[model samples]
Target chain A: MTSQSAAVLKKKSDRKKMGMKARENVYQGILWIFLIVLALTMILPFLYVVILSFTDSTAYQAGKLILWPEKWSTEAYQLILSGDGFMNALKSTLFITVIGTPLSVIINAGLAYMLSKPIPGKGFFNKYVMFTMLFSAGMVPNFMNIKQLGLIDNYFAMILPSLCGAWTIMVMRSFFQSLPVDLEEAAKIDGCGPLKIFARIVIPLSKPMLATMTLFAFVSYWNMYFNCVMYITSTAKQTLQVYVQKVVLSSTVSDVVDLSMDLATTVPQEVMRMAAVVVVVLPILIIYPFLQKYFQSGMMVGAVKG
Target chain B: MAKKKVKYKATNKTLRQQIYEFRWIYFLGIPGLIILLLMNYMPMRNLIMAFQDYNPHLGILKSPWVGLEHFQTLFQDDKFYNMLKNTLIISGLSLLTFPAPVILALIMNEVRNAKFKKFIQTSVYLPHFLSWAIVASLTFFLLSTEQGFVNKVAEMMGNEPTAYLFSSKWIYVIIVVQSLWKSVGWGSIVYLAAIAGIDQSLYEAAKMDGANRFQCMWKITLPSIMPTVMVMLILRMGTIISVDFEQVFLMNNAMVKQQLEVFEVYIYNNSIASGSTQYSYTTAIGIFKSVINTGLVLLTNWITNRKGYEGVM
Candidate 1:
């Protein structure tokens, strides 16, 4: 039971390790290399966008892979910003994200909280929501309905149509149900009404989940494309995504002649596209690391053991 | 906000009392229900447009009823079949690659070094946050005939520059790769969570039984996460008829447009694109697709349940 037996056991396992260690090393080594390469592939496209955006026209004109620039330049940014359409798009995108996110979170939280309660008709309510999750009306009918609501060309067309979805509500309902009921029980005993208990105990206690939902709503609103396209017809109401798509995918730029010979010469289309890509994604990239845990936690809810 | 509400005194409340007690909660749910009614249910009601001659001035209700005419057009149209085929192929290819993240997650679970694992996770997850617009731009930069990074590198290595952007040959492959790159990391989170929820004791027991690392993973980790894998598979299969229009549309060049005319893109083109608004026909097309998707979901859910796992539905 003491040092002598321990020594024998250690030696026995040590010998086994000696044989298996080499194979394990190879396995582990290959795993690491495969993962490292996979990670780099994910990262490099974004890096490539950022790098090419900043690369001076000279390096770009070299017809070589521009990994690093001899001289970093902001001409692309200057040119993209110089366009009123791009600026308008950015402003509207920002407007949608700001307005949509808070409204979305509150709606989701309220509906989810009510679902979490032992309210009458709750089961029917759940099924009703779940039905929406399973089958959505196709875009045309949905567009017609939105148009009938007088949301066409309206910002609410973008915001209201997709403000709260059933899948999100279900996920959030689970979150609410997972919250400790003891606080509510105590609040009830102290003669605190349901609203008071929810406003005080539930809201404060569920900050992490709320934060995660907030970020998700924010991201969805920020990345919104389908709604923006279907609902908002006017260029003035178009979003960053629409703007970026026009800049990035449409090779001819629609009216290249209007680009002006001087501007085209100074800042080529490719570089401008790269810069637009960066501008569109910069906020997410900056906040991503800080909010990464929230994302994981939200998904892994009720799954984590330790 | 209601200051005059009295404290509950009843030990066993009647239905009326219970309903009255929950009134405020019901009040909280009003705005959401209204939104759902307007945004979701109203659209569903307007799905009647698929059977009618939808004239905007007439509105959906007053529009002339043309039962099954739009549906007939949808089925008879060659473009409809083409769109359906493209949608199926793209979604099917993507669904086949769904397990990529599961494999990645398993490999990730094997890494002993926490820091290195964190680095990999962080790096991989970033791509998911990128909007389709950025990915499309990135694709253009990679595939551009002359100044593209890939072509430039190919030229530097004395290889021929392939017409990646200007050709339809690689459109499907391009879509698959783009989806994989964007989703694999985010998709793996669920599998990783499943792996995390596996009993650690099972692994230790496997180790004690002289099972090697691969043996342990195969016998223990793999079997443990099967239910989760099944659930995910069923869920994915349900939506296999629908493809992401944003990604396909944004990535579409004239070269690839014919090859990549998915249902959503077709709808967008006919109903919402500049100068076209064939609402009745497009509505019929959408209804047909959604019906197929919904049927697939129910069918897959029942199959999964028959196999003894809890159904995703």
Candidate 2:
């Protein structure tokens, strides 16, 4: 009688274990569905924009959401590229990004290197940089200062005002500090001066960090909006982001299209806006996958050290 | 002992010589120092404009000081109070959304499939790199009344289209939602790192004790990252007055400007866009914002420090 009761109890426990397994499976399935929905939310908007850029204007105006256009056209792309509004903005953006990024990296690297070493007055310099991080002069005064310097309507307004970033300097300084001190000591024994060691030894080993900083500076300069709005009054000198803002947000899209009437291809304003977005975002998207690996490490290092 | 003292004196002499030798290193830093002085410190000095009747021609040094005039005007102005209210509401909503990314990271951490995890991570992080202009355009395209995707979906569901962007009723919701969409994925990264730092043995032990997955997560993971969450929250509190200026500027229109006008927009309008030289008044508002931000940060730091978490000093 005791053996038979024990077998029945064992069967009951087995059923309970099965019930828990089923519940766990359901929970896991629900989580998967939620994550997939979230992933779609992130990806679909970008994909939709791309699709709309290529969709026929009439079809888009007909109120159909185009995930994949039945008929794709390159008219919007042609319109954007042919127009002086976008092309000029593109040129200005490229010029600033090319010139400003290297200039910023060099300045930041120099300051960061100085802060990394056991130099006299290092504490004072560190405090100076940190103070800037903590406080900022308001927009009016900064604008007034820039105007006094005669940088209004000039490319220097874009490049010079943002040449050195305290955060980037600190990141680079931490990176420098992390390197083995034995190498620098060895270089010192070989009679290499501070500048020589920095140029020849320290820099060579810091290519990854340099790339990360350069990419950061490039992106910041490429996406400069407010400064251009505040400083650059000329149509020819404005960056892509500001121009995109004008065309997309303001009532200037019709004006831009009218000014570009010489172009044979005519795309609707909506399509043209999406095309502009694609153009502005394409460069970053292309380079992102390659630089993404480096960026993750760089970000971790910066966050941990800072 | 006498010999050691003589050697220490010789080393002190070399330390001074080392300072002289590193002059070139300091030379490399000079340009940065000058730029910082011009760009950062100069404007800090110009904060005095908040106390003066600033004139462009008269310049900062020559401007006559009017103590408490701007502050008194700021306190008296209804528009200033409205802007402060709007700023607080929008930022308060943002503060409420701070834990969203933490929750997302926790959810993502539970997923066992590697491929699915990678896809979610890669897709979600894509938005962070996009400029606010692009985001604004996308938001408009997706939320606009006439031909927006959301309206289209609503129409399909037999509902009338809603003018979301133009309606003041929806502005706060739009701002907070857009901010979350843009940052939630990127913000999860640090929390994920913190979670990864947790010991696997704890999980194993919990499981051995017949604890369920949810129980293990609650009893272990969340507590382990509380300090990181606290630090991030404090830092975010420090910038509560400052909204994303570009996003606000892009989305703002005559229809919703009353609701969307925050401190940054107010400053821009009075000074740059308005073509008015109300520099002193705007500077006063700016100073007010900075003081509040600093106070909030210090207050949070003190509170967190008392709780024995590392504060972001």
Candidate 3:
């Protein structure tokens, strides 16, 4: 009797285990479907752009929407890359990113370092910083101020106004606060003053936060269209993003059909627009992987411990 | 050691020791203060431009005082009502949709498989890296009248294709949907961090009490992240009047002008109009906007506080 009862109990437990395993499998299947759908949404448009860039002008004119191009050609890429307009804009974008990002990171880091220390009138400075974040004098005054400062129509115009971002400084300050004081104290005892300690000891240890700030600043400066439009009047000085804007705006045949007859045969408007986008975006996307480790880890360092 | 102590005592006897003690503290503040004064405080003096007929030639002090004339003109303008309406509608829709990321994060936290969670996360984050210009172009290609993917699919189904972008009726809806698609993944990062910080022992304890995954999520997960959600909601409410100027400006045309004419774009239009460089008038409108935004943020925080969570106020 005891052996028979034990066998029945074992069977019941095995059935429960089987049921749990089935549920787990079902959950896994649902998760896979969700992820696949998300992946398609994220990647399909980019793929579409690439596919259209290769399609010939004749195929584009015929309104063919085939994913696999009926007539694959490199006319769009050849036109955009070989053109003087694309090259100048590309150069301006790279210049802005390289010059503006480091300037911002260094200046903001100096301000952050100062604010992070336990010093006299620290509360006064902190409040002043917070005030800027909450309220600004708005765009028109900012424009006038920059113009008066003689930054308009100049590269410094683009870089200076955005250099000392309040949020970034605040983030860096909090990040510095979270670092142990012992590291800096030891350096101080070894004949290092504040500046030397910041340069020699603190900076090397703060690579992740610095990297995150650099990437953010680089992207912001690279993608700046408003500053280019507002301040930059010369066609030659326009950044890539602003150029992309102009291209996309004028690309539709309906808008520019009356401009000229010769313009119609230059290239398919859709292909040119896509090619510009690809050029504008490709560099940043390529650089993103290098900063991926910094982005995921450093973004959270000083965000919300409070 | 005795000689060193004697030297220290000689320095302490002098006024130099007292000065040195406080010197480092004051020195640390000057660089940051100089930047703040130059960048932030100096521009604040320009706020006075709102009260004057500001002219570049006359400068701030020499510009004619206009008193409330600019504010009066701003109120009388026909576009003011429409601009304010559009701003509120777009902002309200965003507030409604902003919680989607938080919901997504909660769902993600429930996933037992680590690899699948990472896949979904990495894929969702791609759109945040894309600029509004690219996003707008993508939308146009997908929703264009004749050659768009959506229209093509509709044509295949024996139905007429609807003009999605040009339709005034659908413009706001399109803006909200686009905003959601671009930001939902990145916005959820904060909520995910808050979720991850929740104690693992809570989940273990719940499991031991016969609670299943769904029950644990409902009873433990949602409550744990409520404070972060409240803070984010309060902060978003603070910027209610501000719109993503880049996205709307890039996407909009004459077709959907009525629907898509947000306050930011409205300001841009006024700035660009011939002889519309009335800096005072523009400054007045800007001042009004900042006031309204600040008031709304405070009001929302008040509401949140009444609900018993510590709001941003």
Candidate 4:
């Protein structure tokens, strides 16, 4: 009788274990479904914009929306690209991003390298940068200072004011400090000076950090909006983002259609807006994958140390 | 002891001499220092405009002193109070979204499939790189009443199309949703890093004790990343007054202006966009924002220290 009862109890425990395994499977399945749905929410909007940009005007007006367009057309891209406004704005944006990013990286890296060394007044310099990070001069005062410098309505307005960012300097400084002092000492023992060590030894080893900083500066310059609106009063000088804003906000479908009627071709306002978005976003999207490898390590350095 | 005193004096002399030796290093920093002075410090000195009438013709130095008149005007303006209220409400709504990224990070952590996890991360990080202008345009395309994707979905469900941007009731909801969409994925990155740093031995032991995945996450992972979450929360709290100016500016329209005008927009409209400039009054408002921001930072830092978490400062 005791052996028979023990066998029954063992069977019951085995069944319970099977039940728990099934429950775990169900739990994981639910979690997967939830995450995929969340990711779809992120992705579908961009997909919609891309699909809508390709859809012909007639189909779009008929409300025939799908993941893929039934009748694809390049009319929207042609119209926007042909426009003087779009081309001019694109040129301005490219110029700023290309020129300004390198300039910023150089200045910030130099200042950071200086700060990282155990030089005289290093503590004072560190405090100076930190204070700017914590406090700001407010919008009006900064605007006033820019005006006083006669940078209003100038391209230099975009580049000059943003040259030295305290946060970027801090990040670069931390990265510099993380390097081995022995390497620098060795370079100095071999008759290398400060500038020589910085140019040859320091820079070559700091490529990943410099690349990340450069990417950040590039992105910010490309996305310049508020500064352009405040500083560049001329329509010809406005960057792509500001111009896109003007187009998206000020124009309607009927207005675009009427304008297009004169040119013997019809461009829907929706399609034009989507095309503008693609144009503004395309450069970043193209370059992102190349620079992505540095992002994880770069962010680690910034977050862990800073 | 006498010999040690001489050595200390020798070191003091070397320190001063070192400054002269490293003069070139200081020169390397000079350009950046000058730029900071021109851009950051100069503006701070221009905060004196807050107390003056600040006429462009008279210049900053010659502008008549208004004393507390700008402050008095700010205190009495009905629009100022309304804008303040709206700013607080918007900021409060955004603060509610602070945990979204943390939750997302935790969810991502649970996925055992490495490839799928990476795909989701890459896809989600796409939005962070898009400009606010593009985001606003996308929002309009997806939410507009006439032919928006959302409206089409609603129509298929036998519901009337909703024009979200035009409705005052829906503007804040739209703003909050847009902010979440833009930031959640990018923000998760830091938390994911923190989670990655957790000891794998703890998870192994949890499994030894028969803890399920959810149980392991709750009992082990969440508690492990609590300090990171607290630090991020404190930093966010410090900027409670400042909304994303570009997002607010681009999303705002005449119809939604009443509900959407935060301090940033208010400052722009009064001082920059308006035909008549109220430089002093606007400067006063800016000062008030700075003070409140600094105070909040100190307050949160003090509270965090009291709670035994590391303070951000």
Q: Quote the lDDT for B247 in model 3.
A: 86
Candidate 4 per-residue C-alpha lDDT over A1-306 given as tens digits, one digit per residue, 9 for 90 to 100: 999999999889989989987887787788789888988988788777877788776666644345676678988877777777787898898888888999999989889998998776677899888777767878888888888888888888888778888989988897889998899999999998888888998899999888888888888899999889888888788999987777776556333222333541466777778877787888988988866575356454353323
lDDT of 1 by residue, A1-306 (tens): 699999999999999788688888888899999999999898887788898899777666646677888889998887777777677888899999899999998887888889999776777899888888779898887877877788889898999977878877887788789888998999999999878887999889888878877877888888888788778878877898888877776665523223333466666667878888888888898888776676456444332210
Interface RMSD for candidates 1 onward, in order: 2.7, 2.5, 3.3, 2.4
* Over 4 Å off, model 1: A1-16, A250-264, A295-306, B1-14, B274-277, B311-313
RMSD in order of candidates: 4.6, 3.6, 4.9, 3.5
Kindly report which residue pairs in candidate 1 clash with one another.
Answer: none
lDDT of each: 0.81, 0.82, 0.76, 0.82
Tell me the number of clashing residue pairs for each predicted model: 0, 0, 0, 0
- Work out how many backbone clashes candidate 2 has: 0
In the range B1-313, model 1's lDDT, one tens digit per residue, is 1221222233366557878989889877778888888888888887888888877777777989999998888788999889988988999999989889889988999998888998898998888777887788788888888778899999999999988876888889989999999988888887787788788999888888888888888888889888888778877877788887889987776778889999888788888774435888888888898889888978987877888776322
Stretch of 10 with least lDDT, candidate 2 chain A: A297-306
Rank candidates, TM-score, best first: 4, 2, 1, 3
Ranking by DockQ: 1, 4, 2, 3
- In model 2, which regions exceed 4 Å deviation? A1-25, A62-65, A250-254, A257-266, A295-298, A301-306, B1-10, B14-16, B156-158, B299-308, B311-313
Please provide, for model 4 over B1-313, each residue's C-alpha lDDT reduced to its tens digit, 9 standing for 90 to 100: 5664465476775656777877777877888888888888888988999899988888889999989888899889998898899888988999999999999999999887887888788877778888898899889888888767888888878888898889999999999999999988888877888788899999999999988888999999999988888888887887788899899998888999988888879888888777338887888999988888878867877877888876322
What number of backbone clashes does candidate 1 have, counting pairs of residues 3 or more apart or in separate chains?
0
Every candidate's chain B TM-score: 0.90, 0.89, 0.83, 0.91
Query: How much lDDT does candidate 3 score?
Result: 0.76
- Off-target runs (Cα >4 Å) in candidate 4 are A1-24, A62-67, A252-265, A298-306, B1-16, B156-158, B302-308, B311-313
Q: Chain A alone, TM-score for each of the models?
A: 0.87, 0.87, 0.90, 0.87
The Cα RMSD of model 2 versus the native structure comes to: 3.6
DockQ-wise, the better of 1 and 2 is 1
